[model samples]
Structures are given as structure tokens and as C-alpha cells.
Target: MIWDNNFAVSIFPILLQGLWVTVQITLLGTLLAAVLGLVFAVLRRLAIPVLSQVVSFLVVFVRGTPLLVQAYVAFFVLPAYGVSFNALTTGIVVIGVNYSAYMAEVYRSGIQGVPKGQWEAATALSLPGVRTWGRIILPQAIRTVVPMLGNYLIQMFKDSAVLSAITVVELMATAQAIGSSSFRYIEPLTLAALLFLAVSYPASRLVNRLERRYAPQH
Candidate 1:
């Protein structure tokens, strides 16, 4: 029950290791989400009838479904179909895929928020589609959406703990395991909370600062 003996001696190391796993998953998953979401956003914006419809359906399905269910399906169901991934990989894929749907929407909104005049200006300049988007639209859209993307990153970080359900040994899972084994919940659970607070608080502040810095001036 003592704080010094239990927390500092036994629980800190285990929680620290778990935090590392959580950070790894969050970073990898966020990268995947960013890449895939941007692809989906661009595809949808292109308005290619069949391809657009297919991407729309995918985004809707992923966004409509629960992430935990996705995790379970990835880990438990995929093996029956001759596709199997390790728990950690499955967790990353599930989290990344789930968030990509939402991030796609975020990206689409950001892209669309660019004034129609910009697109027209690019067209009048005889810029190719790729060049126009790359040079004119994407830069502004990305700057506008950076804060939202950062918020998603923080959310992803917290949600990575859910990977423990599949035995991924992330932060929450490590705390649960250590607490159960040692029959001491206070120290491990407290350590996990502190770790989350330590990262999330600063990340949230950074997101706010980004939003302020990028806000369009009057």
C-alpha cells in the first residue's frame, strides 16, 4: 500500500515499458492513417464515379463500425480466412484503418475549405491537376488541418491502450497485468494515469497553439 516501495520499485518500470509500446503503436498507426486518409480524400474529391462510390462505401463502413469490433475481427476473424497478423500488427492496422475513415473526412473538409477561386486561378494558369493540387491546394489545406490531425494523433495515442484487449501489452494492458499479478492496483494504475496525462496534456496544448497560429487573419 505504500507509495514509495510499491510505485517506485515495482510498478514504474513495467508501466514505462508499456508506455513505449503504446507510443510505437500510436506513431505507426498515425502515419498509416495520415497516408491512407489523404489517398481516400483525394480519390473522393476526384469524383470518378465507380471508384468514388467504392471509397465512399469503405469510409462509411469503417467510420460506422466500432474500433474494438474491428480489432477483434482483425485479430480473431482474419486467421480463419488465411490472413493472420501478430497481435501488435493487428492492433496497429485496426486502429489505423478505423481512424483513416474519420481522418479522410477531416482532410476532405480542409481541402474543400480552400476557396474555389484558388482552383480557378490554378486552372487559368494552365497548371496540371497534380501540380495545381500539390502547389496550390494541398499546402494550404494541410496547414489548416494540422491542428485537427494533431488532435487525432492524441486520440490515437489514448486508444492504443485498447490494444491490450488483444494482448498487445500496451500501457493499460501492462498496468492491468502488473496489478493483477501483484494484487496491487494503486501504483500501476496511478502510473498509467500519470503517463497519459504527461503526454496528452502537452500534446493538447500544442494542438491549440497550432490552431491559433494557422487561423486565417481577418
Candidate 2:
């Protein structure tokens, strides 16, 4: 038979290990992206003379560049400048920062969607800027954008495969390694695709559910 079920069963455990690493990268990368994206969104919203413009430019630059190239720079070039991280660490950060540029726009849209009355009410209450944002504005803004963030989380999970190029032993990397060693690409590669679909399809459904749950009532 062309497909070897016994071999697939044997390699299942190893693939699971790589999947775990992929999950770690996705979770940590999304967390980092969420935090940094919020910071970027807030900085640009503040409209600080030069700072906001610089942040805006950086966001655009990151968005415009290819992620694979960025990963190469982080993995290869940064070490030359005395900035270095292990492959896994570099992958997580590069994915996070790459996603952050996109998330910043999502966050900006959320923040802008806040009711003008909310801002006026904050002013009338004499709330400090930080308190006004922390207490009133951000909570509402973040709620509206939660679904969008979840979508990005799903996207980053799939995109993590790109990090395999830099030797981060993710699912795709594991599959490739198995193929190279065994000269049998069919089972491992097919299994990897199935594994990805299994996770992403459910996650997308959950995101859709969240979108319905959080949508503003007419």
C-alpha cells in the first residue's frame, strides 16, 4: 500500500510534540501581539507630535514587509549586532511583532468606535486621562475587538509554519524532518495538514460565535 498506517501511528507521538511547540508559539505570540498592539494603538491615538508619527511609520513598515524576511533578520542578522535569542524565542517575538502591526489597526478601529458621549462623560467627571482610558474607554473598545483578535489568533497559528524555515521545530518542520529522514513524505505531510485543519476549523467557529455574542444590538 502507498500509505503506511503503522508508520504514521509510530510517528504520531513525535508530531504531537511538535504540535505542542506550535501551540506554545501561537499562545505566547498572540499574547505578546495583543499587548504590543494595544500599546501601539494607544501611542498613535495620543497624537504625540513626533512619537505618534514614528509609531505610525513603524507599523506601516512592519505591515508592508514579508514575515519570512523579518524572521530571517531576527534569526540571522540580529546576532551580528549583539542582540540574540534562541530560535524558538526569535520565532515567537518575530511572529508577535509582525502580527502586532496588523492588530494595531484593529485596535485603532475599536478605539475609534467608542461613543463620543463616553469621552464627554469622562471629561465631565474630571477623570484623569489614564483613569478615563483604563476605566471607561478601553474596556468598551477591547470588547468590540475581541472577536477580531481571536481571528488574528487563528491566523497566527497557521502562519507559525513560516518559523519552521529558521529551524523552529514546529509541526511543519517535524513533518519535513520525517520526510527527509524516512523518504516517505505522504503520511507525515498528510497528517500535518489534518492536524492543522482540526485545530483551525474549530477555532474559527469559536471566533464566529464570539462575534455574534459581542456584536452590538441594533
* Model 1, runs deviating above 4 Å: 1-4
| Each prediction's whole-model lDDT (CA) | 0.90, 0.96
**What is the per-residue lDDT of model 1 for residues 88-169, given as tens digits with 9 covering 90 to 100?**
9999999999899999999999898899999999989999999998999888888777888899999999988888988898
Compute each candidate's TM-score over C-alphas.
0.94, 0.98
Clashing pairs in 1: none
Cα-based lDDT at residue 82, candidate 2: 100
Question: After superposition on all CA atoms, what RMSD does each candidate show versus the true structure?
Answer: 1.6, 0.9
The TM-score obtained by model 2 is 0.98
RMSD from true fold, candidate 2: 0.9
What pairs collide in candidate 2? none
